[model samples]
Target: MKKIIFILSFLFGFTSLYSQKLSSNNSKAIKNFNEAIKLYENYNYLDAINKFKKAINIDPLFIEAYILTAQVYSDLNMFDSSIVYYKKTVEIDQDFFPNAYMFIAKFSYMTGKYEEAVKYQELYYNHYKLNPTQRARAKIDLNIYYDALELYKNPVPFKPINLGPNINSIYSEYSPALTIDDSTIIFTRKVPVKDKAMEQEDFYQSKKLPNGNWELAMPLLGELNTPNNEGAHTISADGKILYFTACNRSDGQGSCDIYRSYKIGNTWTKAENVKELNSVSWDSQPTLSADGKTIYFASARNGNMDIYVAHMQKNAKWSHPQPLPDNINTARSELTPFIHPDGKTLFFASDGHGGMGGYDIFYTKKINDTLWTTPQNIGYPINTHKDDAFLFVNASGKYAFFASEIENGYGAYDIYMFEFPKNIITTPVTYFKGIVVDIDDNKPIIHAIAELFSLKDASIAGKAITDIDGSFLLPLPAGEIYALNISAKNYLFYSEHIELIEAYDSLDPFVKYIYLRPIKKDQIMVLNNILFDFDQATLKPESYVELEKLYNFLVDNPNLVIEIGGHTDSIGTKDYNLILSEKRAKAVYDYLISRNINPQRLRYKGYGDTMPIADNSTEEGRKLNRRTEIKILYNN
Candidate 1:
């Protein structure tokens, strides 16, 4: 025995004396590993990873160190590193096989390596029984992977069809918005009104029935309607809130401001203006996102109407309104926006991008969090040479509803529904027809000016002159209130505020009848009421009231004017009657002058006995001819 130099180069340097030193080093390594564990527990994963790496370097064979280091890498989302270390642990000790395999499976799933994840998951499952929580989590991940695989393999076929009369009506009804579950629907309907006094448009709504046929349409109740005009409503996904436009009054912030209302049970509460988003310019046509976290609307505040958006903050307040990205809003008008249920596609009507003629339906798809692609025109058959706006699509991404003019329509415009194919849809249209007559006589009032004012934009939108039969036709946007004014030369200004909340589903045209009183001499009419005075060569203060009526009449007629002549009773000399009548005629001229009536708009002449209709011999007859008369001098 060569002195048996048992130079024990202990495999891990564990000579009895060296064992103490090795234990000390192990303790140091253990201390470092424990510090890293503490960091890992607090979720300081990056720092913990550094500490774990240092500990493993000091003790290359520290099995526990390798296992925890792999876990720390996994916590930091370094799945590849976690897999490498986990594999090393299993290689060093077969006993750690199952746990290593399970971690590798989890990491693979985290990295989207679904096939590898499934293979390792099977191995883990074969050796270990997972608790309920682990099983549930694993199942969820599996389902996600399966769905993603399916999505990648084949995209779902999107076939859009036009919702026929089952949901739409002849009167303009469109801009359909619905709740997330598709249980409720809120849409705009431009229907005719019964006894509508103003020239403004009309709109109404209908609900879905159990059998899927929409129930008879009804106008929205409560204070949401006005005689002015209101429509283009947007309902939140829950169907609990509505936003619309109301215009033509002193309370408006501008031409129109956005308004909101909340549904309480079957009725809606009073609507309040969305002042935060309104400006001195026009604002209308609001559309809310499916999540109710964003609002899109049209505004003319920047001189031309364009689309803008305001985000809903977590605190329930709206953020400052900002113009929509360049892809959506342009210099031209962009209105009637509809955000689809998927919250990834935006549909809107735009005149900026060239289309069929007027505003055409277009769509844009969201590419990423802050990016959207250029819009695509919903081409040909769906659009036409006229204005085609206010679109609504159902939950299945099929079936659309909109407003259009059809042959033999009941009124100027009507709502229609057709099979709008995902690829191509024929233009569908309808109309609402009715007549306007004297409310008292039931006879049609001719040449009466009918005006429709939008309550949302607070401005006059459309006007029509009654036909020879006192009948007029008007097109309406759905879900709005309108103020109708029907004024004739001698009739009291006929006015009626129409609320279209109930107009939808009411299969009849909005029948309107107006009564006009005659204006003649000795009618106790105001003379300044007639724009004249006794012996004065100037117009009096009260003259404007009557002259304004005349001015408005002229304005409405556009091509009508007359000569105003004056006469007197023969209670004086022939020279006196002629001279007196002439003075009276000039007096009438002076009166019109003060009222800003154009001199060229009138002619004046006096005929003493020349134009008398009654005998100057009797006081009654003389009084009748001692009058002022306006004869139509020009008519176009």
Candidate 2:
């Protein structure tokens, strides 16, 4: 309405300057034009349009009448008709209203006439003398038209498959979030309230069957789904924690604010407002990283909606939210930011970055802590004339899920799945899924911390905590070797090296059953992540991460005495293997002592091939046999 008022006032200002010349010579045409203006002011747009057309019929060259009719059609969202009348005014006198060319270009683009839009936009830019701000905006529009034309000519492969009736209905369903494994999907469903004109939004979830079909979706259980609106959510990689948007509740700080909930067993806990993220203005559409340590969401605290980010603090509270750089957010609304499991690529929706029309989906890469790459439109068709948002890419980077109101859909906005072009994804990702258990009774070990470290820089890649069932998932980014360390209180830590340097697929993930032995006398555990050069005892630099973990374990258990044991495979002579193993054991013993583990409490031993855990006939068995082990000699 504001835009319409502005357009009407601007047109009136221009026409008033040439009222004598632009007006029709026929008094009947002038009378109809005045009556049309009165009808438009009364909000009778259809009647006003008819009156403007009557004025145009009375005097075929009445430029003001033609302009008014086009404006009315535009307000009615009849862009094709709007373009026709605007073009008629142009045919009469193109110089009468220079801004008319701009409108025609915009309407053409909105109606998907890309080439025509580009032509009129170029004429508008070349003929008009615009101020700096106006010129910049016009340039942006021109670029958008060109880009839309290019993409329209070369479309990406996009076939959106609906999630089906089990997860969708006659009601609108959108804002879909998926677990890392793609085993579950949670989305917002807009359902009509009983006997009311208003609709209510609630969270719904569906689990995938072994046959790869989704089970019937049901409203999330527990106090999480209240009568108040709940929508636009994100689930943790493991699907145990949920961060979502809720509005008009007693606990809200704004009309709409972000809320968080936890799933325990089969029920979700009551949602609590994320006060740190909420403001007096609207804040919503939260997305969590794979590690659940960072969040990206949209907020209108500074007026127009922009993407904001906050990191989870050590105290478990979120840090103060900060908006993304201007390169990503503009003077217009930006919403529904989804950070991929890779922790770098971010997909969002923005109107500020000009594209086809309305909001278009864009993606950017996080270059560093303070910088991000410029956002790029994902392309046409995937991003149409209508608003396109809420893109959720699965961990594999192979497919994405979004909502659309398309032909044959079961709902107004049904969740749809589409594959991503491999070229568009900057980095692929996979998850490390496994269970941790006690070695003695084989019982699940809850609250064990699983941390992944990039072997290149030894920086932390991702982390996860074992659930009640001892299940955990850690995101492993592509193109790196990672060392995984799992530790729990009162238990020996476990370590293993995961190689993902080659192309990795999410469908084939790294799965393991970790057995954590209780710290006790004579308990021996292999330090699987410890590395050395062939036939050399000197520790490689890659061994430091695991070595640090081992050092921490010894420091935490100061009263225990341990022996470092090194074993050899059956490929070498017993005499040579014994000497080599002894030297390797001594090397670990010396390193631990140098790190302040009391030498008096440490011992070194060579097991050679005498204590092979696996048959040393194959390479896998031989690799398992040649290992470094830590055995508790005495526990006080």
lDDT of 2: 0.87
Reference-based lDDT, each prediction = 0.61, 0.87
**Candidate 2 global Cα RMSD:** 2.7
Q: Which ten residues in a row have the lowest lDDT in candidate 2?
A: 13-22
TM-score of 1: 0.39
Runs off by more than 4 Å, candidate 1: 1-174, 181-183, 189-196, 199-203, 408-412, 419-636
Worst 10 residues of 1 by lDDT: 1-10
Over 4 Å off, model 2 = 1-9, 12-21, 128-137, 555-559, 570-573, 615-618
Clashing pairs in 2: none
Per-residue CA lDDT of model 2 for 152-237, tens digit only, reads 88888899999899999999999899888888899999998899889899999999999999999999998899877888899998
| Predicted model with the maximum TM-score | 2
Candidate 1 structure lDDT: 0.61
What TM-scores do the predictions have?
0.39, 0.93
lDDT for 234 in candidate 2 is 92
Best by lDDT: 2
Give the per-residue lDDT digits (tens) of candidate 1, residues 343-413.
Answer: 55678888776544456678887676467779876765565435667877543354565655555554344
